[model samples]
Target: MAAGQKLYPRATVKKIVKAHSKCNVSKNVDVMIFLDYVLFMQTLVKEAAIDSKQAGERGISAKSIQKVAPDALSKFKG
Candidate 1:
């Protein structure tokens, strides 16, 4: 939820995503590109609380992440 501070580290996110969706996250480009946003989402919810559908929502996708990333990144850390 903060700069250089992952609310959900990549590995953690990948694991949760895999568990919920039964889909490996390491193989996706968009998911990779949008991972930061997904991690950021954990700040709003509980740890590993975000589901794949939520992560894939238009508002949280790669296209929208850039718009919100800066704020999301700073919400918790600094």
Candidate 2:
């Protein structure tokens, strides 16, 4: 990924926020949410990769992600 490139589209993030939020979402809030989501996904993938390696797997698998998801979610939960 290039520096400053967005992994999630701004419009999509705004739409998601609008759907879930009762009030209007500001640009800053949208950016923050996008960053938080990216961070969470990155952490989740990294953990899954480690778990797969520990299990002697060649790549991260669905099972590894499932096993790590709960812990990851809890850690990132607000």
Candidate 3:
């Protein structure tokens, strides 16, 4: 996905950009951080969905998450 089309909302990106602007980091580094943040958030969403789904049953499994969020599974698989 494009950096601007990250899972995070526009407000979140604006906040992060504003926070990083105070530092002297290179634009390249900022972009890297932004990508990492997006991945982290996507992972969190996947994990949370799996956890919630499994909360009422046996332990969570990858297949369950795949059924719930196919794109999320594809990201990891790809």
Candidate 4:
């Protein structure tokens, strides 16, 4: 994805960006941090869905979330 496009939904993307926009950091460090953030968010959503299901609540189904929040679909996939 283009750098600009990669940071869609500026509000959410900013969390990753700002965390790395420090005074001193290697390009590699910044990239690694961003990747970690992405993976963390992805895992968080999936786990939340699973946890909700275990609790007998209507868990956030992967497919249903993808359909409702297409923009967030990337966060639900493997």
TM-score to true structure, per model = 0.28, 0.71, 0.40, 0.42
Q: Give residue 64's lDDT in candidate 4 (0 to 100).
A: 46
Model 3, 67: alpha-carbon shift in Å? 21
- Put the candidates in lDDT order, highest first: 2, 3, 4, 1
**Selected candidate, larger TM-score, 2 vs 3:** 2
Model 4, 1-78: lDDT tens per residue? 766565445454445656766544444554665687787667667666765677676767665444445444455444
Candidate with top TM-score is: 2
lDDT of each: 0.56, 0.90, 0.62, 0.58
Candidate 3 local lDDT, 1-78, one digit each (tens): 876675646555556776867754454564666677688667856675677666674655665565556555556552
Per-residue alpha-carbon lDDT of candidate 1 for residues 1-78, written as tens digits (9 for 90 to 100): 668885546666567777877865655534665756676676544322333245665334444545555666677452
Superposition TM-score, candidate 3 onto the true structure: 0.40
The ten-residue window of minimal lDDT in model 2 covers 22-31
Estimate the TM-score for candidate 1: 0.28
Stretches off by above 4 angstroms in model 1 are 1-7, 27-78
lDDT preference between candidates 1 and 4, better one: 4
Candidate 1 C-alpha error for residue 15, in Å: 0.3
Clashing pairs in 1: none
Model 2 Cα lDDT, one tens digit per residue, 4-57: 997768888788878887678887787787679899999999999999999999
